[model samples]
Target: MASSSSSSSSLNFTVRRCEPELVPPAIPTPHEVKLLSDIDDQDGLRFHVPMVQIYRKKESMAEKDPVQVIRQALSQTLVFYYPFAGRLREGPHRKLMVDCTGEGVMFIEADADVTLDQFGDSLQPPFPCYQELQYEVPGSQEITNTPLLLVQVTRLKCGGFFLAIRLNHTMCDGPGYQQFLSAWAEMARGATKPSIAPVWRRELLMARDPPRITCNHREYEQVPDTVKGTVTPNQDDMVQRSFFFGPLDIAALRRLIPQHLRHCTTFDLITACLWRCRTKALQIEADEDVRMMCVVNARGQFNSPLPVGYYGNGFAYPAAVTTAGKLCGKPFGYAVELINKVKGEMTEEYLQSVADLMVMKGRCLFTTVRSCIVSHLARFNIREVDFGWGEGVYAGVAQAGGGSFPGISFFCSAKNGKGEEGIVFPICLPAAAMERFSQEFNHMLRNKNQPQTTSATLIMSNL
Candidate 1:
């Protein structure tokens, strides 16, 4: 057994490939957990956000004979996460991949980052990294999970080690993921009783082999790209940056919008305001077209309910529109109008398009949809995703930016009262353009006529 042990403690960890003999008899995927709950499927409605926490160990965690113990624990845990072991195969769901194996899912990757810890470097950050092969684990030396996750750990030029964790959206949301990670951490610490033993019943999430096409599904589907333009590899055209916006800024923006304008939500204010800034930066023509695509959840959108364990891909992209000139010229309220109007279209029709398109070509449409130019507004409550360690310092969306989308941004709530909400965005314009864009954004915040800024910026450094 191959294992790495931390020098300061008796606890050691072993990393090994999952073998069939170690797996337990499989169960069906859970497709139904509940018919319906009070969870609202609306624009401002909040969902659990997923996160990967990194811990640095000053002392070595490698053990001489820890492989067996780690393997035993992995075996037990494997039975619970069997669905992941299944491979992605050819099916109506193009997002999934399946080789010769009847099953179609597997763990993406997990590794160590010693160099990050020893050198005392800050968390490197969210970047474009992925492994082409589905089942193999990636090391720090290579990019892994292009659209998924990439974790790198190296023995820094200094002493300690870094631990990086990558998680895919399909697996679980933030709250659900935190629960799973907490349990794993406990197990790693040698806790006798796991906090939340996983409930692995595939039937809870399994759909009919052919799947039933209903209005709900139809509303979420989009035309697969196989029939559309081909996607050439995108060169790096943008710079990814992490910006912090505080409470005062958000509050001011809220104040700018008229009370009659529904008091202007966070997303509403930011989208409208940024569209103004982007127009200035890119110098888009007044009559030129621009649209903001806000993602909507369809999990409980239907009149009928779904199972609690019904965790497959369950989201749709809806577009909000504005003319570059109008968006730039309008008062904050006018921008808010675009956000509200566009958000309203996240109906059954939009969702069905996504589903209908996927099943038509089976596997050809998945990559096509991912390559399109679309800006997404991901709004969520970051505080709720607490593990045993407590709530997170910051929470924000991580995506593969650059040539993929010229304009993409994410909004996350500020942790505690630290002030500004987090913004994860990619700026693909030239230096002068980026400078102009930043100026316009600041002007909106400082302008007493605009809505108030929410919190203070925490970490505004570029990625």
Candidate 2:
């Protein structure tokens, strides 16, 4: 039945035998490591919300041999399963292994008429299709009884189709995901095999036994009062949407920030600008405390170290700071300064603080940290998620649009420098606030001294 969808052309693909890579040889980190049994404590600390969108021109040949294209595509895309290495003890249950079920990829169907505009329309402004998948997960979890890949098909008025790929972020970062896709595309194009094989053994990242928490870990964990929250923003309080910021504009803004502030790199500059924009958009009070959260990959942060191919969640949260009033009034350059100062806090002491708190306080720490925070920016490598269709225009998470205090956001880039140059940021804020925020954001991009295009806009809605 699946084959019937494809044309009779030479194009053909299939999900043959694919297995997870062998665990790499590496020392294990003992003291700081959490066994599968201890994972409950890290529950919400990590979320698996990775997804991709593929755009392809419609062709008569494709329709004639739907399966051919799909199969070819599937063949090109590589898939694998990473099993939980450590044993989990729960009462009588001796050893329970955790694997990302064979379901790690999904396909969404859409026709040509569903331009990015319409897709955005369907999502409804701030709320975008990308963000709606969270609701789809629980239902999927019920259907598959585990984290599974999801695919959707939609017929558009035009001939082309849009494919949305959803995967559990826990499995891989954007780059890793792209590598798998590129391999699949090659296969779909009739390649005998993928260009590069995937690496999955967690042993590669295992730290020396008796893992020692490095001091740098402490700096990234510290945060502020007003920025922290007791409860994370719920669905009612937040919506989701995707926004594009052209690279040229970002580059222009980058030139504007003082030299002292630019040293921290891309994340610092973009985030600092955003902090200023969000503050201006919301017209936040100068005295009110505001914070911006950034994801820190913990793979190499610890003193002991982690195993290579450690495919589990290895991320930490650090933040930039500002008062509502200060952020709103400052020039973009000043915001960069704030961003630099706060990021400096991510030091060994901070890591230790977080480790001690986690070990001493246990699960409660996760909650304390999650609540006392507002907005999260995970700069995971997005450009790497390439399926056979070449590189992606952009890849990343959509924000939960309309929200109360402490908004959460995500940033990623396109496969190539094709679509937008800078990061694809999904922001969620109130309508009134975003309008104002958009203005300042544009102004920063179009500074006469360093002018840039205003390609990104906030289409507020309840997708």
Candidate 3:
């Protein structure tokens, strides 16, 4: 993990947790082994992903106990989403499958001394008291033979509460996980079933017989253990901070773009800015390679569209590589174009080729060599989850980021008290580099009054 993360330290506190317990499906599920799609058990995604959601009490929910309601709802919801109740097991050749043991998922009920408002007005990532809010049971940390999901509901003094959940990555991707969450919320509202039933056709993504490696997957290149130009810092030296971009901030970025290249999306522009600014902050050697990746969800990007309810790791991170100096020195459009090209290349052929590459290379890890990966969770409808307590003030990854590798971030949808929707993402780096990064970032978010180049001027002109 990255040396340090932003903790909910503003108001120091701890949670009083009851003994954790497993909640099984309301009804028995099929007892059988289900082979996961090759993409599901890949080396890059074999860990648990945690999320934190904050629900402000609504008048209608004043009398109801959210913990009790949600606990029952999860049990009922698991009957339909039973795969999540099963444990992951290794088959021959290191392939993974669900044991369908019906062991159920872990759940905890806890209470906190602080009120939700006391935590802070802004409920976003890098939240305070992260470990306490998202408690993990001991002996339940392994990737296999453990509950696929662990949930903790911490009640606050003000009626508003927190819902924290940790899920195994191989079981689902962002969209799939969100889908399951929506179902759980629906059940909490007394729905007989999920609006869209899940489809477990993992076989749909099976690797082609006689797997063939077609494209040069530079993102997975086997390089020296010590990667170049990465924004790595000592454990005690890192600072995690989140940046927000609203309509006005985005307009500022767009104005810098040339008309022809204005077609670039918010994703492209922001990613371009972050890569450039981050590269400059690192002050990496001019000749060393620096890579920026955009994680593209392949739901419909493949030859055949994945079914509406299909939930698995159906995604890929295509990298845009260049020298640190080149990326930092290039016009903003250059970086945007690089990102668009790699993202556009994620067609059916590209996905299939990746599946083949995975098996062929013994499921290699994504290149950690000076690589920065950014993903957007807005499309996943993370905030739409309403567990009968009205919508949550915040709903997204528990921690914006800190992974085995450095340079990880997530762009999530957020709204203020005024209901102004915007994008917020968190990134962690050394204290000194963070200062430099913030300086460069402010320039990118420049207003008309701030004298500056548009896309840094020459940056987007070529695209």
Candidate 4:
């Protein structure tokens, strides 16, 4: 999450941008409104999520201008993914719908004085001047009646470019957005249509007739909005930093687990480790429940698997909770088990319950009390996209958590400075916790002899 040279030096650049304009589909789309599923209209996804993809220059394509190619590709791509060109509108009962108006999405062309190499070895999250890279049109940040997609392509000094896109989270989840993006890339490569067709079966994920709440959805449960200690930091005090877990780092984590539980995924292992380290760094009181939420792609969870190109929100946030004391005091397996349980319990019925709860609660936001949410974009095929220039060097979320709140991190599949394949996840904490987290996290990877710290043990005695 830490920006390389983002804060340190006198690194400076001026971005010259053209006036933003609306880009519509090359072919006309039907003019009608499409109702969004309960999951899509949830409170948590009511804003635009920004992403940045850095593409290095390709000698073979030196003559072509990426800006023109991408801009044209986006126009052609929108013909099939037309909903992205529409504006979202809210209906009665807080439901959301897209007015399939061909008004188009916001697009801008720009050139930056800095080259890709000037950004240094890492181009991960917490990118410097991210807002400039993915500029928001005056009222485009508003939830309704605005462009569902905001795109800005800034050519770098070395001929490489940064393709920045901000899509309404309500329109699509990780997979959905990736599908749309890959199609755009295909179009840029002169493909008349996407290799895989896009589908708008939002109705498939809609709440069952006479919605019923079956599962106990703790992720969204409203609780006392309290923080007893200085564990949770103010938005201003938070700092972003990323940690890369290569194959060796993962092997080290697995060493702590029993052979049976070692079958758990790299995500489970790392999330558990992070939750424990963060909880220890926070020093949250024992007996106080600390929560961790994982964004599970529920496409296959349905009895009938979701269509491949059905680009809608197909993920669910299932939460795992345990007291901070137990989390930090117990062995690493304790945290891993909690995560495993949350993953195992999610089913089609569970997703339906989430839908029911959304309507019943009038679209309440996910619970934030003593909690942090983690979303993984590693398998979204970000690095596979090619706009003729070729696959990007770095492609993922533009930044860590939103400015309003902290503790939200993203997992991206990337190589380290040493070019080792692994997962790179970024975390934002108050300066003090950040230092402690870095020290402990590095200590874990470097020295296996050091015992896991046992703190807040007294609180473990309580229920």
Residue-level lDDT tens digits of model 3 in 298-407: 99775569988998778888888898878877777788889878887676777788888877777778877677888878777778788998777888876645333557
- Candidate 4 versus truth, CA RMSD in Å, comes to 5.8
lDDT of each: 0.41, 0.44, 0.79, 0.80
- Candidate 4 lDDT over 115-145, as tens digits, reads 8877775476666666667776787788899
The C-alpha stretches of model 1 lying farther than 4 A from their native spots are 1-51, 55-78, 91-163, 167-237, 360-389, 395-406, 414-430, 448-463
Ranking the candidates on TM-score from highest down gives 4, 3, 2, 1
Residue 78, model 4: Cα distance from true site in angstroms: 0.5
Question: lDDT for model 2, on a 0 to 1 scale?
Answer: 0.44
Indicate whether candidate 1 or candidate 2 has the larger TM-score.
Answer: 2
Which prediction has more favorable TM-score, 1 or 4? Answer: 4
- List RMSD in Å for every model shown: 9.3, 8.9, 5.3, 5.8
Give me candidate 3's TM-score against the actual structure: 0.92
Model 1, range 307-368, lDDT digits (tens) per residue?
Answer: 44443444555555556777778777887876766666555445555444444434222222
lDDT of candidate 4 vs native? Answer: 0.80
